[model samples]
Target: MKKIVLTSFALVGLLISTSCGNNKKEAEKVEVEKEQVTPTETESTEKETSESSTIVAIAAANENFTTLVAAVKAADLVETLNSAGPFTVFAPLNDAFGKLPEGTLDGLLKPESKETLTSILTYHVVSGEFKAADVVKAINDNNGSFVITTVQGGNLTASLDGDSVILTDSKGNKSKVVLTDVDASNGVIHAIDTVVMP
Candidate 1:
């Protein structure tokens, strides 16, 4: 009887030990799963936040602005525009750069033309976050035209070309805002079809 009781107790203990071990493994697996899931969630949120944070980031994300992104990096204006204070960037698309005179883009990308390229790029950036509506309103308020000072120390004239906003560079070349109100944490980007000169 004692032997039987001892054996039974041993079996019960074994069963309990096995069951406890399985539960521990399951708990550990759940913890690992939780750890894996948490970082994924956080990473997604961070990626979304970073994607819309700056003009550079926004331009880099768009396939059409590859040339512009390269130009920004070339001009060393990435950090300036990516800094702060609500800049309004009139970003030119790759097709717009193609519209430049032959060898113009190539010359500008050269190391010797850094100052000139920086001036041209900075000419596209105004020191404030002006959305399309605000820009139009300012145009209207200024009697059908508004002159905005750019980061390059040049002035860009904003006028209404029908329902669209047209930006005129100092050299009399005009670039129409193809897309507007690309809100970035640092400012706004208005994609232009033409690369405005300083």
Candidate 2:
């Protein structure tokens, strides 16, 4: 059988409904360099004590994920990402969110847009853990492409771009995975260059 990963979280689907159409507007190619920064050893270890943290913590600690962290809060998904049982999150960096058309971000952040925002965020998440190597293997095993079902009931197509993993969202937007295998106590995060629409 071809390798295809499909995980349906009925409970998660119950929590989110309705996708925002406005987010489908043509997006600019965000400059990833502006979003990521080299972490110094001291800042990297912020605390001398060794304590396992969750995905939310890892994202909150990194300046590159500021926008993502805020969106999680806005969507009230901080607790979900903090939970156990390894999730695979295609996290978009700050500049990725910046790529959205004008007013799109602000509109999604509004209280009225919570449902749409929740669906959009969850669309970037997969139920189980999938490392970069795992994704690559699955794609190659499935004849250069694999379709992954998101928690939101939307599908994301995973394929290869040279050595990189590319995710094509429901809206046909493509995001290149720039950073992968960011392990957390709860899950792993792969940073992407664009915000994939649901």
Best by lDDT: 1
Error of 1 at 25 (Å): 33
lDDT of 2 by residue, 1-198 (tens): 122322345434544442222233222223333244435455567532223378888899999999999999999998788777589999999999999999999999999999999999999999999999999999999999999999999999999989999999988989999999998876789999999998
> For residues 67-105, what per-residue lDDT tens digits would candidate 1 score against the true structure?
999989999988887786689899998999999999999
Model 1 accuracy (lDDT, Cα): 0.91
Give lDDT: candidate 2, residue 70: 91
What's the distance in Å from true for residue 142, model 2?
0.4
Per-model TM-score versus the true fold: 0.74, 0.74
lDDT at 141, model 2:
99
Candidate 2 TM-score versus the reference: 0.74
Error of 2 at 43 (Å): 28
Count residue pairs with overlapping backbones in model 2.
0
lDDT of each: 0.91, 0.86
Model 1 ranges off by over 4 Å: 1-52
